[model samples]
Target chain A: MTDTRMATDAAATWHARLDSPDMDWEDFGRWLDADPSHRAAYDAIAVLDAEIGERAAAIAALLPANDDEVAVPASDAGVPDAGSASRGTRWRWAAIGTSGALAAGLALLLVAPSNDGAAQVYATGRSETRSVTLDDGSRMQIDRGSRVSVTGGGTPVIEIAQGAASFAVRHDPSRVLMVRAGGYEVRDVGTRFDVVSARGRVAITVAQGMVSVVPSGGAIGDATMLNAGQSLTITPDKQIAIRGRIDPARVADWTDGRLDYDGAPLTLVAADISRYADSPLVVDPSAADLRFSGVLTIGDGSRLVDQLRAVLPIRARRVAGVVHLDAAGPR
Target chain B: MLAANRHQLVRFFTGRTGSVAEAEDVVQEIWLHVGQPPKADGVTGEPGAGPIANPLAYLHRVGMNIVLDRVRANGRRQRRDAGYVDATTSTVGAEAIDDAPSAFDAVADKERMARLTTALTGPPEGAMRVFRRHRIDGASHAEIAAEFGISRSAVEKHIAVALRHLRKALDD
Candidate 1:
């Protein structure tokens, strides 16, 4: 073989080896020190790998055991095989495992500031506003009755399990910011986006810059890069596709004292308000299809009840932070 | 109209009878009755009937009964109305709904807009833009709100002043 061909073969071999969970650290370090471009390439590959694992965990949330077949299609060469763990257990894979753990750890990332040193949880009762400062200097607001677990694992990772949660991510490309729930996984290299999980689907709306949601895993095969005004939805089965533009203001309105809905389902509004309310907004048989527009002020119960009574003709009253809505007067 | 307005009826019925699907079923019944409206029963009255009071209110009450009867036939007061208003609208509007929609879009709510306008009195006109950029647009107000923890009054004040100024500017 020609000298150039010999060198090319060797480089490809090395590149493949580094991606394996068991690649030699000494050899990898020597390579990284050998060339700056080599280090950059490695960093890119590592970030990409971490993202893939994260996507899997996100997809895992929505997929039933039956869906495991079609979700990680047998034809997909890019997706990790469901049987990957059987190959070998390597500590180097710890980084990958940590990324996976972060993805898994993410479901528990909600609650006060203590789940993880870097995690910040913002919770609100019905009609109450909750704000939090993340370790990365970003801020998050958890709308009434909702709990979000935040962690700064591979990047500043966070997961919203239920209700409504808003993220104001600090710009840090070096640290990826992610939010996971149901079938939705939002990864921002460093952008602002709001992720809401309700019903069985997760909706990701980009407010600024760009963000990417690939069917819970990072691959060009299933990824859709979203820009400002763009949005994506992850179906109940881990399927994701570029949806359309959503109102950026409404996406992050919980913190701003406005719960903006353009004919949203009462179930969704209930989910959003459930976070702030001490008592959940029960979308009853009478209230489920009700679509409310304009801002539903959330701060205290009596006021919320009064507001519901005044604006929409629904009766609502707060017990603790839980504001119950009913057709009957201020129950 | 049943499909198109099924959702609107859900919202309207949601306001009145507090049943989204009952409102929806009423819409279904209304569609059956008025779908071909011989221009008699559907008109409610004549054109000169003049801005009828509580037309929607009366319809909402009618729809509620229909839904209740349907539910009562099966016999249940569901803790959760999982079947009301099919998610067709939610799924369709999911991507299109604006959270921080452009201020320039035609907002249909005049009273709320007036309230937003009235709230702008305390801050300078630029304050609303800042409010839009930081709060509405989701910018961290650390630099704009001028503190790590922004106080409620400061935010209200910024908006109030901006609205007041806008109201004045528009008046001229």
Candidate 2:
């Protein structure tokens, strides 16, 4: 076979294998890194596969169906009749249109912020993350279990009631957007920043522009100007610390359903996950201080414990509706 | 053991099938095959039978077989559907047309469906069968190989050919 043909076939095989229940991810990673063409080919097939699957029913209906074929039970075949099929087609197209509108809304949220008193309150459930368009046209992606109320008139103000929220604030010299996250306030001159308030701690990370972090009732002298790629952590004990050179890419990783950490305390990991899970995840005193580094992909939340167990000398179990993580004993 | 791997298997198949909902059905089918002993007397004498040395590998093998079988079934369906279309179009003047797709259907949906139909119709019969069994009916490659009296590698080649054809047709 020609090299290209070989690569394509290999990519297809790998794609199927990766989906296999017993796939070894490490092996797959090795194969992916072996050849650049392999990754490209695999990506091509994956994208096409998704597109076709998304329209699988419509495509199946478009095929000429025999009287006998109709009896063949493909329950997912949504196009059983002309009338209902038309409805399905309309719904699909409507969804496509909504996504287009979302794109436009996203553009406006980034480029424009109008100061008008359009009060909007956005909140997310334990398992929900919501993106809101403020009256000023700025956008905020509220994390799971987070609540934020926005007032868009003259110097728009956002009150982060609880949990984490990321802002893509539009630059306006005439007005400054102020975010009241717990006792700390983040005043955006024209910037993108994330405020995470959890576990008696508040963290502010900037992705772009500059923001000043000030105490709720303190003088401007105490205010600290944080530029792009900076992070500030405030504890309940009133200790404020700043960490520079924050990887901007990691600022809002949670929005993508991933928790990216590098040498972070397992206690904090458990705390972050507790926001989404039904039961609180408790780290035993010994395991609490142990640090872990990895990307935990959020699914059903059980994977977090599984991954933690895999790399650490730890054990996780559900006891009385609470998840507990403790140091493991050797067999 | 199967229950523990259920989510992982679903995630795996989701990548291939592109829909988690569809992938759930595929994973469930794998579980059924695993739970069945493949014997009336419950004897464990068959080759590689009894205790399933590695459940993950077993699940993987069975899942692949299911995909291959699905490919074969889809190929048969395509041929049958094609014949039905041909007969109807040929008898247009002689026979009263029935169940003809309405022209009022959404044009974009129709166009996409047309591309898929065209893609499914053109591959070689054997390759198409293998492809359909796996891709459409969720048959595993192993089962397809066994049913067709061919090596597993041959089945893979057939599927690869079908995939290439579908990819090319859809890309166009």
* Candidates' chain A TM-scores: 0.50, 0.59
Q: State model 1's lDDT.
A: 0.45
Candidate 2: residue A13 lDDT (0-100): 58
Off by over 4 Å in 2: A1-118, A237-245, A300-303, A317-323, B1-172
lDDT of 1 by residue, B29-132 (tens): 54432222223212221111112232332233234334333333232113114442122211111232112223332253334344433433223434544434
Residue-wise lDDT of candidate 1 within A1-331, one digit each (tens)?
Answer: 5533333223323322322334333343344344445433333332222222333333233323431111211121121211122134333433342432222222111111111223444555655657777655577777655667766433356768776666666643223456777755666644567777765557777787666554555442234566666666655665544377667766677667766777766665666555454455665666665776767866653355456556665666566665566566443
Q: Model 1: how far is A284 from its true place, Å?
A: 6.6
Estimated TM-score per prediction? Answer: 0.36, 0.41
Model 2 CA lDDT for position A220: 48
TM-score of 2: 0.41
Scanning candidate 2 chain A in windows of ten residues, the lowest lDDT window is: A82-91
Off by over 4 Å in 1: A1-135, A198-201, A215-220, A231-244, A262-267, A277-290, A301-306, A313-331, B1-172
CAPRI-wise, candidate 2 is incorrect
